[model samples]
Target: MRVLVQRVTSARVTVAGEVVGEITPATQGLLALVGVTHDDDPAKAQRLAEKLWQLRILDGEKSASDIGAPILVVSQFTLYGNTTKGRRPTWNAAAPGAVAEPLVDAFADALRALGAHVQTGAFGADMAVALVNDGPVTVQLEL
Candidate 1:
């Protein structure tokens, strides 16, 4: 599993001109672009969610949990895209939808279990994501 974590001031995901998920945090928050691979399971999702909530990237090096920050989780199989061979990218490292969707849900659920406010985009929708990245801080984690 992998996640692209971005600290943001506000963010939202829209589908077909309709807002699907949104968050305008009172304090700094995170946007987690989660991807799943063939070997990933629910356990990995849980661990990563906990790690994301505790990650110290917000103001004063505080964690999302520390500041009661919300997290917007989006399914992003492209995180595993590979382009080492040719101009076109390959999806060989990404898990098939059947294997990925549930894990994405598990990731959000884990965040909720950790007392983090979790918002999310539709699993397989064509979404327009908007965000104001705070400090322009972004981090990537793979596990």
Candidate 2:
């Protein structure tokens, strides 16, 4: 599993012109783009969630857990895309939806279990994501 995390002042996801999830501008939050690959399981998802909750990339080096920051989780299989061979990217490293969707849900659920408010984008849907990245901070985690 891989997660591309960005510290955002605000973020939202819209599908078909309807907002499905959002983190209001009143607060600083993290936007997590999660991806799944072969050999990934629920345990990995849980561990990643735990790590994200405690990660200190927020203001004054405070973690999300310390400030009770909200998190927006979105499925992003493209994280595993490979382009080492040719001009075109390959999706061979990404897991299929049947295998990835539930794990994405597991990741969000784990964060919620850890007392973090979590919002999620629709899995396997045509969507648009918008965010104002705080400090332009971005981190990639994999397990």
Candidate 3:
């Protein structure tokens, strides 16, 4: 499992020009881009979701769990891209939707269980995401 966490004041996901999910926190929060690989299991996804919820990347270095901050979750299979030996990026490491969608939902479900308000983009849909990045802070984690 891999997650790219970005601190954001607000974030939204749209599908077909219609807003699907959104989170505009009173205090800064996170925009999590999740990717699932073949090796990732439900437990791993849940753990990473917990980690992101408690991660202290907000102003004054507070965790979202501490501040009741909201989170926007989106599926991004491209995080496993491999471009080491070619001009084009290969998606071989990324898990197929059949394996990935459930993990992505598990990640979001875990966050919600942790008491964080979680918003999610439609899986397998063409989405346009918008966000106001707070502090321009972004972190990547692999578990």
How much lDDT does each candidate structure score? 0.93, 0.98, 0.92
Q: Supply candidate 2's per-residue lDDT for 76.
A: 98
Q: Is candidate 1 or candidate 3 better by TM-score?
A: 1
Residue 72 miss distance in model 2 (angstroms)? 0.2
Q: Tell how far residue 40 is off in model 2, in angstroms.
A: 0.3
Cα TM-score per model: 0.97, 0.99, 0.97
Q: Which stretches of candidate 1 lie over 4 Å from their true place?
A: none
What is the Å distance of residue 111 in model 3 from its true position? 0.6
List the candidate 3 regions with Cα displacement exceeding 4 Å.
none
Candidate with best lDDT: 2
- How do the residues 1-143 of candidate 3 rate in per-residue lDDT, one tens digit apiece? 89999999889999999999998656687899999999999899889988998898888889999999889999999999999996999999999999999999999999999999998999999999999998899999887
Where is model 2 poorest over a 10-residue stretch in terms of lDDT?
A: 19-28
| Tens-place lDDT digits, model 2, residues 5-70 | 999999999999999999999989999999999999999999999999999999999999999999
- Cα-based lDDT at residue 66, candidate 2: 98
lDDT of 1 by residue, 89-113 (tens): 9999999999999999999999999
The residue pairs that clash in candidate 2, if any, are none
Cα miss at 141, model 3 (Å)?
1.2
Tell me the lDDT of model 1 at 47. Answer: 92
